[model samples]
Target: MKIISWNVNGLRAAVRKGFLDYIESEDPDIIAVQEIKLQSGQIEIPLDDYECYWNYAERKGYSGTAIFTKHTPIRSFIGDFHPAADSEGRVLGLEFENVYLINVYTPNSKRTLERLSERLEWEDAFLHYVQQLNAIKPVIICGDLNVAHQPQDVKNDRSNIGNSGFTDEERSKMTRLLNSGFTDVLRHYYPERDDIFTWWSYMKTVRERNIGWRIDYFLISDSIVDQLEHFQVDDHIYGSDHCPMRMTINLH
Candidate 1:
């Protein structure tokens, strides 16, 4: 099965730029998107084969997440794990026969680290939540986590150090998560490779120059690492500042 993740930045805007077309072409079994920036029922997506699940922030045109899946899950969750963290519409989960897919849009620490404390609190809550889920079954986590994780994960580590997404605290939280038994599928396959990234700044000439960070990811419980068949970054396909990343798994 092919599972993909992307941060559309804004669903309405991405749709105008051929979002549906791209979805139809990839035809992934399951796909999760972050930063949808729309309230529920504001727009309808015409995907007949897939069941749609959405979590919208109370504030309109703000942070949000959604999942589209060809297979119906036995159970789906919009909230209930953590109230305060869930208030932002940043997480949703679907329980399949053997796997639980948790889609998240992690809070970003502001440029000056204004929200760093809150961001860390969210991280702690999220890790605990996922661990609880993993205790039941392997979990597949994906979305715009908003941290570069390692120096190699972003371009210009020296120049970008201490920036919002590349800060030491944020990076350490990512390390703690990975250490807790999740495998970052891309780095698992391409440990030494560099220059490959998922998100780019919207500033002029930044993306053109390929200056980007691998903030979006597909992470799974370590038990399923052997089932991972293919992983890649689709840098060429673009409608938002971020690009889509995909992974295929051999379930048998």
Candidate 2:
């Protein structure tokens, strides 16, 4: 099955920029979207054959996530981290017969590191949530993780060392996740590939120069690594600052 993860920046703007056309061309079985920046009635996405699940942030035009799948899941849940108040709408979990698919939009640490503490807390809570789900079944986690885990993940690593997304603390959390029996699928396939990135700065020539960061990912429990068929970064397809990252796995 082909699964794709993209941070669309804003659902409405993405549609105007040929988002549907791209989807049709890729034809992924499941597509996970982050940073949708829309509420239920604000925009209508014309996905004829996909079952759509959305988690909208309480604050309008802010962070949000959605999943569009060709096959309906056996069960789905909105939030697993904090039950009572999941106002940020960062996660959408879909349970199939074999695996639990989690589409996440991790909170950014902000340029000034103002939200670093909250982001760290979120990393802990989110990891706990994933661990719980993995205890039941293997988990497939995908979306914008918000941190570039290592120097290899972002261009100009030295310059970006202490930046929000590249901070030591943030990168350590990602390392912890990977060390906790999850495979970073893309890196598993292309361990030596360089200059391949997912999210680019919108500055005039950043994308052209390939000065980008691979913040988005497709991670799965180590037990399922052998089922992974293909892992890719579609850097050419772009609507938001972030492009699409995809993976294919044989569930059977």
Off by over 4 Å in 2: 83-85
Give the per-residue lDDT digits (tens) of candidate 2, residues 1-252: 999899999989999998999899989999999999988989877898999999999899998899999999998898757631179889988999999999988988899999899898888888888898899999999999999987889998999999989999999999999998899998898887768899998999999999999899999999999998888888999799999888999997
Top lDDT: which candidate number? 2
Clashing pairs in 2: none
* Per-structure clash totals for the candidates: 0, 0
TM-score of each: 0.97, 0.97
**Candidate 1, poorest ten consecutive residues by summed lDDT:** 78-87
Question: What ranges in model 1 sit over 4 Å off?
Answer: 79-84
Query: What are the RMSDs of all candidates, in order?
Result: 1.2, 1.3
Please give the TM-score that candidate 1 achieves against the real structure: 0.97
Q: Cα lDDT of model 1 overall?
A: 0.89
